[model samples]
Target: IAARLVISQRTAQGHVEHILSKLGFTSRAQVAAWVVEERQSSS
Candidate 1:
């Protein structure tokens, strides 16, 4: 994501962590699972 966005890896990680915190997630896997569910539901 950092490479695609032209940001430092640490910066990308920080953004992801912040988002997960706001959404009550403790790990990236949780976020990934939620995203998959959300997309499936929307579809």
Candidate 2:
């Protein structure tokens, strides 16, 4: 993800961690699942 975003590894991790904290998510897997569910519902 850091490579794709052209950022440092720690920066990428920090962004993810911040988002998860704000959303009350425990892991990236939870975010992925929520995104998939949202897409399906919107479709």
Candidate 3:
């Protein structure tokens, strides 16, 4: 993921933290599940 994003490890970590906070989720797994559900509903 870091190679694809072309960002440093620290930057990736910060992005993950921001994403979690923005989505009101405390766990990465929860965010992943929500994203999946969203995509499914949209499709």
Name the top lDDT candidate. 2
- Candidate 3 has its poorest 10 consecutive residues by lDDT at 1-10
In candidate 3, which residue pairs clash?
none
Kindly indicate the candidate among 1 and 3 with the higher TM-score. Answer: 1
* Structural similarity to truth (TM-score) of each candidate: 0.69, 0.66, 0.62
Residue 15 CA displacement from its true place in model 1, Å: 0.2
Alpha-carbon lDDT, every model: 0.94, 0.97, 0.90
Candidates ranked by TM-score, best first? 1, 2, 3
Total backbone clashes of model 1?
A: 0
Cα lDDT of model 1 by residue, 1-43, tens digit:
9999999999999998899889999998988898999999999
- Best-performing candidate as measured by TM-score: 1
lDDT of 2: 0.97
- What stretches of model 1 exceed 4 Å from their correct place? 35-43
Q: Model 2: runs farther than 4 Å from truth?
A: 35-43
Q: What is the lDDT of residue 16 in candidate 1?
A: 89
